[model samples]
Target: MSHKQALIIYNPLSGKRKKHSAFPILLNKLSEIGYHLTVNEINEVNNMNNPIRKACTQKWDAIFIAGGDGTVNQTIQFLAEEEFRPNIGVFPFGTSNEFAKFMRVPNNIIDVVSVIESGCITPVDLGKFGNRYFINIAAAGWLADITYETPPFLKSKFGELAYCLYFFKKLLFKKPSDNISINISDTVFSDLSLFLIMNGNSVGPLERLIDEKICDDGYFHLLTYKKTTRIKLLFHLFAKLLNLSKDLSIIQHTKINEADFMLPESISLNLDGELASVNSSYFQVLPQHLNVFGSNKNN
Candidate 1:
C-alpha cells in the first residue's frame, strides 16, 4: 500500500509559546498513522515559494494548517484555484483561531492529531465573495474595520483582546454610520449598521454569535443589524453576546444561499478575519465544497 502523503504548513510566529513544543508531537503521531509528512515553516507572508504553493505542485492527501484565520484564508485562495484539493486538518495555533474553533478542532496538539487519525471528515461549505473564498465569515460595516485597523503589534501582543479594545475605542468616538445595501432572497436591506454572512456561529471570542449551532448547512447565516445609535447598539450587542437576549428586533437574520451587496469604496470588507479586496458585490455559498478533518458532532 502506498503511504498517504501529507503536507504541513505552519506559521512559525503563531502561538509562539506552545507551537515549538507541539511540533515534534505533531510529526510523530501523524507518521504513526501512515502519513508521509513534509513540513514547511512559514517565515513571511506572500513568499512565492510558500508551503501552500508548494503543496499545489504535488498530490497531497491532506494539508495541515497551523495558524489563525488569516493564514487559513491565504491557503484557501491558493487551493480554491486548483481542481484537486486535499482534505484540511487544522491546528489552532494563532490568535483567535476562529476557523479552527468553528471546526471544533481541539487546541491541544495531542488531541488534534487524534482527530486527524480518527479519519472522520466533514464536508464543509465555502463562501465565494468576488474573487476570494472564505470558510468562516464575510462581513462589512461599522465594527468590521477593527479587523484591519488594529495594528499588527497590538494583535501580536494582546491576541483577541486587542480587537475588543479597539472596538470600544471606535464605538465611543466614531458615530456608527454606513451606506450599504444588501439583497437576499428578493428582500432588500438598504440601511445596516453591520452585517455578517457566517458559515459558523463563532466570531472572534463570541462563541455563539448566532445563538444556534451552525454547520455545513447549504445556506449562509445572514445577520444584519439595522441602523441604530452607537450606545444602544453596543448595549444590545453585549446583551446578545451574554445570552441575555434571545432576539434583537433591530437585528434581522435569516438563512441565505446567496446575497448581493452594494458597498462604498471607503468601506472595507472583512473575509474570515482579514481585509478582502472584492470588486464584485455578489456572494454565493458553495455547499460541501471542501473536506475538513473534523468530527460530525462539532456541527
Candidate 2:
C-alpha cells in the first residue's frame, strides 16, 4: 500500500516530435511524494479512455494527466462520461500545453511536478460540448479549422507560431467554414466565421487574452468573429493577441454559460486541439466541476 494512491495517465508519443521526455522525472517526483503511481502510457486515443474510466470507477485519490492538451482532453472526455470522478492534477509533458498554460502549470515538467506534489487541489470549470467535455476551450470555424490542418509535431516545436502559419495558409487558400448559425441560450446569431466557447483564462500562447478573475466564476468565456474577409481574420487574431480588443466587441469576446448550435455542414471541431464532432449540438459550463490543481487564485 502507498501513503496516497494516484492514477497517472500519460501519452508517451505526445509533445513536439516526441522530444521532451519527462516521464522519468515525473515518476521520480511522485515516488518522492509517496504516491503509488499506477501509470498508463497511451499508444492510441482510445487507450486513454479505458484507464481513466477504470480509475474514476475505483475513485483514485488523485488523477494526474501527464501529456499535452490532446491527452488531457481525451482523459476528461472519458471522466466526464463516467459517474464517479476524482480531483485532478497535471504535469505538462506535451506540446502547445495550452490547457497547462491556462492552468498556469509550469511548462517545465519538473516545475509542474513540484506543484502537484504540494497536494493543492483547486476546483476549475469544464465546458460540456454535447455529451463530450472540454477543459480549456471548444472552438469551431476558420481559425479553429487550422488546428486540425496544422501538423501536431509543429505545435510542440513552434508552439503558437504553428497556429499562425496554418491560419495564414488557410487564409491564402480562401478556406473558411460555411456560414453557420449559433444560438447562445435564447439569443440567435448568424453569419459567424468562428466561435470559441472557453473557460481557461488563456489559450495557446495568448496568456493575457483571458482575464484570470473570470476563470472560476461559474461562467464560460466566449469569443467569436463574424463573417468577414481574410484581412479581417488577421486583424482579429492581432487584436486578441495584442489586447487591442476586449470581451465585448460584437466580434471579439463575450461570456457565455450555454449555447445551442446548428452548423451548415459537419465541420470539424477543435476541443483543446483534439478533433471532435457531434451532429451540431449544445454546450454549457459545468462550474467547479472537478477538483483540479491549477492557478491558486481560483482555489
Candidate 3:
C-alpha cells in the first residue's frame, strides 16, 4: 500500500498543557503508521490560512488540527470553499473541544491518533452563520458570549472551570436581556433568551442536549431558551448539564435544515467557542459537507 501523507495544522496557543501533552507521542504514532507528517505551528492566523489554501492544491490523505473549536471552525470555513476537503482529524487542544469530544475522540493523544489511523472517515454536516461556515456549534444570547468575555489568563488558569465560574458570576450581575424573537420559515420562537445552532452533538459541557445520534444526519440542531427569570434559567441549565433536568426541559430543540432570525437587539454569535458579532443572520446546514476522521456519532 502507498504511504499516506498528512498535514497537521496546529495553533499552540489553543491550550495550556499542549506542549507538555502527548503531542509528540501522537506524531511518532502517525509516523509509525506509514504516514508522512508535515507539522506547522500557526505563527499568525492569516499566515496559516494561506498554507491551508495551498494544502488542497496538493494531495493530503488526512489533515490533523491541533487546536480547539475556533480553530476547527476556521479550518472548516476555508475547506468549505475548496472543491476538495480531506478527512479532518483534531487533537482537541482548545478550550472547549466540544466537537471532538462529541465525536468520541479519545482524550489520550495516543488513542486520538489510533482513531485517525483506524481510517474511519465520517462525512458530517456543517453550519453557516451568514457567510462564514462553522464546523461545530454556534450560539447567540446570554451564555454564548462568556468565552469572549472571559480573560485569556482566567481561561488558562482555571481551564474549563473558568467558563462555569465566569458564567455563574456574569448571570448574577448582568441585566436580563430583552425578549428576543426568531423566525425560521413558518416556525417562530418569541421571548427567547438563548439561541443555539449546532452541527454536532455537544455544546461546551452540555453533551446530553440530544439523546439521538447527531452527525451524518444532514440537518443542524437548534436549541432556544425561553424567556424566564435568571435564577430559573440558571437552575434549569445546570440541571440539564448535569442530566438532572429532564422533567424541567428548559430548551426548545429540533433538527432543522435552515432558519432565519430576528432579534430585537444585537447579541454576538459565538462560533464554536469564539465570538461572531451579528445582530441577525440566516443559519443553514450544509449536508455532508466535509469528511471527518473519527468514529461515527450516535445521538
- TM-scores of all models? 0.90, 0.89, 0.89
Candidate 3 structure quality by residue, lDDT tens digits, 67-162: 877778777767788887778898878776787886778777888878877787888888887887877777777777887788777767777888
- Compute the lDDT of residue 218 as modeled in candidate 2: 80
Question: Per-residue CA lDDT of candidate 1, range 125-166, in tens?
Answer: 889998889988888888887877877777777878888899
Best by lDDT: 1
- Candidate 2 local lDDT, residue 55: 80
TM-score between candidate 2 and the true structure: 0.89
**Mind giving the per-residue lDDT tens digits that candidate 2 earns over 71-121?**
888788777776778878877777677777766777776777778767666
What are the per-model numbers of colliding residue pairs?
Answer: 0, 1, 4
Q: With candidate 2 superimposed using the best TM-score fit, by how many Å does residue 228's alpha carbon deviate from the native? A: 1.8
Superposed by TM-score, candidate 1 places the C-alpha of residue 183 at a distance from the truth, in angstroms, of: 1.0
Count of clashes in candidate 2: 1
Clash pairs for candidate 3? 211-299, 212-299, 213-298, 213-299
Off by over 4 Å in 1: 15-18, 42-58, 246-248, 296-299
